[model samples]
Target: MKATVYVTIKQNVLDPQGSAVQGALHSMGFDEVGKVRIGKYLELELNTTDRAEAESRLKAMCEKLLANTVVEDYRFELEG
Candidate 1:
């Protein structure tokens, strides 16, 4: 099984890196761009074939290490 995780800052949280990227884009003449939020994308390969078990473990992984629940949100997808 394959799992993919996306981790991003929460809506109410401040994102300095995102802001810096937005500013750089504007300076590069990409004025049409507005707000930008930076995030993380992770892909994992699992040894288990059980979809339910994989999902359960994935969620736990996110809560325990993948995301900072206080300031970040995470979502994952599973693929066979």
Candidate 2:
């Protein structure tokens, strides 16, 4: 099985890197882009075949290390 995790800054938090990228885009004439947000994508290969167990473990991984629950939010997908 495989699991993918997406970790991103919370909506209410300020993202300096995202802001910088947005500013650069605007300067480069990509004015249509707005509210840029930066995030992390992680793919993990698991030995387990149980979808429920994989989801539970993935949630723990995100909560404990993959994401900072205070300022970041996370979502994951499982595949075999």
Candidate 3:
């Protein structure tokens, strides 16, 4: 199975890197761009075929290492 994860900053947190990118875009004539946020994407392969087990393990992984629970939120999709 393959797991695709997206990790993003929580709405209440500040994102300096995202702000910098937005500023650069505006400077380059993309003035319509508004509030930007940065995030992480991850792909993992697991040996199990059970969807329930995969979801459980993925959630654990995100809580433990893939995402900082204090400031970031994560979601994932599974594929075979």
CA RMSD, predictions in order: 0.5, 0.8, 0.7
Model 3: ten consecutive residues of lowest lDDT: 49-58
TM-score per model over all chains:
0.98, 0.94, 0.96
Q: What is the C-alpha lDDT profile of model 3 across 1-80, one tens digit per residue?
A: 99999999999999999999999999999999999999999999999999999999999999999999999999999999
Ranking by TM-score: 1, 3, 2
Candidate 2 residue 2 Cα shift, in angstroms, is: 1.1
Please give the clash total of every predicted structure, in order.
0, 0, 0
True-structure RMSD for candidate 2: 0.8
Looking at model 2, residue 47 earns an lDDT score of 93
Q: In model 3, where do residues sit more than 4 Å from their true spots?
A: none
Tens digit of lDDT per residue, candidate 1, span 1-80? 99999999999999999999999999999999999999999999999999999999999999999999999999999999
